[model samples]
Target chain A: MVIMRRVAAGLLVMLLSMMARAELVVEVTQGVEAPTAIAVVPFGNETGSALSEDVAAIVQQDLQRSGFFQPMARENMLGFPVQQSELYYRDWRIAKMDYVVIGRAVSVGANDISVRFELYDVLREQSLLSEQVTITRDNLRDGAHFIADRLFERLTGLQGAFSTRIVYVTAEQLAPGKQRFRLQLADWDGARARTILESSEPIMSPVWSMDGSKLAYVSFETGKPAIYVQYLATGRRERIQSFPGLNGAPAWSPDGSQLALVLSRDGNPEIYILDLQSRQLQRVTRHYGIDTEPSWAPDGQSLIFTSDRGGQPQIYRLELANRKLERLTFEGNYNSSGRLTQDGRFLAMVHRSGGGGNGFDVAVQDLKTGRLDVLTRSGMVESPSIAPNGSVVIYATQEGTRGVLAAVSLDGRVQFRMPAVSGDVREPAWSPYLR
Target chain B: MEIRSYIVPFVLALGVHAAVLALLSTHWMGHDEPQRKVPRHIEAQMIDLTALARREAEQAHIAEERAREAEQAQQAERKRQERVAAEQRRQELAKQQAEAETKRKARQEAEKKRQKEQAAQRAAEQKRQAELEAKRKAEAVERKRKAEEQARRQEAEVKRKAEAAAKAAKERERKQAQAEAELKQALAREQKAREAAARQASQAVIGDIQSYIQAMLQNGWRIPSTARNGMEAVVTIHLLPNGEVDQAYIHTSSGNAAFDNSAIQAVYRVQRFPRVADIDPILFERRLRKLSVKFRPEGLRW
Candidate 1:
């Protein structure tokens, strides 16, 4: 029952997300300054390696609640060095602090972690951005929001949405308090909430880091449920093969090295791509049965999931180097999570078939022609986030049982909410636009 | 050269000192008999005849017409000597009547001389003489003495030459008509006494020129009353000789600069006038020397 963490890559995993030999000195242009200031520190795991969360403090409260930064607070740090020679540079230019993020988390083995970060320019004392990301404390909050979206695009020249990935849900105490169902691994704003696996039994699909840093979840911890890779700074973890019947969906690989998951391991659920420099998990899908949500394609050469092999749940596009699969959504019978658009051109999903109470809204299809754009007006809208200049949208629904963390502007004018201090704030993850 | 040169001789010792210049020149050094008693009363001011009584009455009427022409030339020399003696007594009576008429006719013709010596001759003859002789006696007495002898010799030569030429012509015609009527009544009484002495010398030369112009016009002539005639002025008076007016000249003008300034303010309001008899000394230059004043106001006229 997990939904939404959809990323469908195609142009060959967007040319293997670089390192055709490695050095491509970046140049993606266009206007950048929307709400975008990012400072994210605290990744130094050293080796104790139990990163439940804190990937640079969940990418600095996800780029400071995305209202664009005035963020230098961490108790007013002028120079917080974890490496790069513990930089000084006039104490961040006497604390004016334009950019000075730092990162560490070393112990690269048993629970795997090699996260190195540097992002300076405290008034030009050099080093605009450096990176070394290898995460396993189940993907150190997706490698600390993927080096905070590449040091928020190298000190704000823009596009470092602190590497996107935030899938929240935290109902932390079962007795002392009341919430017993939570789902949260925050990095896009709700800071370092690192419970990659807690539940009164329920969790959902949270997939990211094809350069966003990391996530991929759907956890009932492991009862009749499975699928996980949790490290957001250093609380280590991983579990990508729970089988017996329909494992769940998990997407990544625009090159955080690969993972487009949803697996019954093989008899029924489909889609897979787990490379990690060749830990090699390939099986694109042979569909002898219903397929589940599997997204990628920011150019990981094709993959868009949720398939009932054409009978009900639709939306499919496979082509990961000729494992050619097609049927990409037809009208709607019950479309599920389909997040594509970082300009692969539109997909935001979850438009269930309307009939009874005209339920589940939030739509938007347009991958060049299959137009939809439904956007919500009343109730159950969920998990949306497409800002970083894709023009606003942040989501989590249920206004009545009150899980509230809404935001919408993708042309439905503007709706809002960031609510929750008490109870029902459910699974809401909207990350991407940072740097 | 110092000390005031000794005070300049003590101030010249109180003014030159020559005994005060001999006590002011000769005061009484030679007084002489009261200076001959005041020049003898100024020599009695010699011009006496009561100050020439009309120039001695015109020199006594020109010396009485030169003594009446020397008394008519002595009555014409006494009638020219009585006509030369009656012409010498008529020449002596014609020399006695011419001798007695040539002797009385030679005595009557020698008496009828012989009277009739002849008468007779005739009768001579006859006389018869005697007879008639008597008749004739009468014829005879003859011529009677030849008429008494020629009347006695013509009456003695006519009575002696008519009584001596009638008494010398009757004295020469009574003295020549009494000397021609006494020389025409003495030339009509000397032409009526020379017209009464030129009518009393022109009435005594008009009564001494009208009492010396009424005693120099008795000098009371004033005429001020703010003097108006044709209002002339020109004043400048300056006088003193007692007719005072020390300074006057208000310059009255008639070229009418305000009626010659009111006739120079009426000759300075008639400073002093009253004295012009013999006019004191022509009154300091004939009085009112500068008075060209003309404001008549009808005062003094001719």
Candidate 2:
């Protein structure tokens, strides 16, 4: 009996010891919001001559501008390994690179270059992506952006906005008083820009349709502010509305069936929804103050707009079904150009804080938590446009007394400036995710 | 007068004696003459005459009668003598009988005395034997009593000694038990104190390791922007004795591949925790061999 009890006690002790070493769990609730470091090795050129476009540079720039990655400089790389067989993971690992991109470009035809790229995790020594594309020399930059989009999506777990485009009005002072206001469309990185409309009158509030096939903006070419829908592929334009008073800030509904615009035909600047099919206008907000900048929610069930009915310009959500006007921003004196992200969980706006001397800056307010985060410190930032993936907000900010396009990550951690060559770029509009 | 009467009786007696003597003598002579005459009568057997013979016969008859009378007197005297002898014999016999009777009586008396003495001797012997037997029995009883008393005393002594020994042994045992109990208690207290100190030290080491690991992970983590506020990925990492990561995998996914992979990649980036290698091996095995990290991006804007 004594022996049995001793054995039992021994077993109990063993069991307790096992329980002690079951598992040690450590909780990590916070992490550095810094960009991931990646190595974009230069692509090997087998086209017999140097390609006009540097595909590696384009890919690197695209990833860097997304505010989620830090591409290693070419000079810092140990070797330019173009394929997995030649890739030495230890080199990148030593350089503290989390990921590596390697590729090679070969001429498939007289004008077509076939580019093959592969993305790898340096730490894991594993390949993440491998693809091949054939494109003309002119489209080589697009191919690089395409590769950047694929890598970005794989690395950040979000849709890459690199392949999308942005429309911003660039005012070039051709003369002392003559200003050429051009509604320009360009890549999201401000590359390959082209003017959709060039006029001496000012153009404002350029927004993309949901399908990314057309654009609707308030162009002043008709000698008054008129909303025009232009087919981007064909350069076809149509006047949607020409109100006697203010007709501006045209926003496309989520389904692209209607455009939500600001109109003062009712004796005050009010929010109106115009059905593109029926050409019928429906007033949604009847506020006495200037209610403008009507932006559709992703669900198209509601519109968040800037209204000054509360004695100060603030962001408000107007439910289209019930016309329920709920104030969305209370932390600022001037919050305008309220735009909801694709998920309708965050509202990015141009905010001027009530107490601080800081001028208009781009801010994002979490609609769920009602917490507002100022994403930019630029005193003159405006026209905040959220990326389709909600990872970044591109806005227009002044650089040395000239307006330039700049972007900030939603968490207010990463920022980059896109300075145009010869114009004051403003009212930047990020297009939805394009095909 | 007495003398004359005596003399007359003496004379009568002497005369009777003389007459008897004379008759006896005459009987003798008469008997001898008949013998001689019988021979002569035998010789003249045929010459008998009646008268002459009668006269002679008468004379002879007278002599015969005298002889006869003498013989009768002799016969009487013999008879008297015979009677006297018979009487004497009877007396003698009587005397002898009396003597024999006396002797018998005497013998009987002696025999009885002798028997009585023998009986007395036998009784004396019996008394002596009885006394000896009684003395021996008393001695035996005394001896038995002495033996019993001695045995009882010995038994009591033995019992007393045994009790003393038992009491001493019990006292010794009690003291030993008390000492053992106290020693055990002191040892228990010492062991408990040592254990508490060890536990505190182990806890401190564990805490240090936990913070070290947390910092390493945070610095290496590149939170994917797609990781929303509520999404969490749990990763388990196995480490070698040298604090190098042997294996790391997602224990629970956040449903987002990139987010989960980011957490895994963070562990891979750290690769090793040098602080862990410095800790005690036992502590490492118990608490740091396998670790679980929960990657929750609460710092993100969305």
| Best prediction by DockQ | 2
lDDT of 2 by residue, B1-302 (tens): 23235545645875786688668756755644553344321111222235543664565566556656787777866566557755765675577567666766776666666667656655655665575566557656765665575466556655756667787788888988889788657755764575467568888888878888999999888887667789999999999889999999999999998789889989999999998889877668778888899998875766
- Which 10 successive residues of model 2 chain A have the least lDDT summed? A8-17
Residue A165 lDDT (model 1)? 45
Candidate 1, which CAPRI tier?
incorrect
Cα displacement (Å) at residue A150, model 2: 0.8
TM-scores of chain A in all candidate models: 0.28, 0.95
Per-residue lDDT of model 2, residues A152-232, tens digit only: 888876878888999999998999999999998888888888888999998988999999999998888878899899999
Colliding residue pairs in candidate 2: none
What stretches of model 1 exceed 4 Å from their correct place? A1-156, A162-165, A168-179, A185-189, A192-199, A208-244, A252-261, A265-297, A300-319, A324-430, B1-302
DockQ measured for candidate 2: 0.39
Per-residue lDDT for A62 in model 2?
84
Q: What value of lDDT does candidate 2 attain over all alpha carbons?
A: 0.84
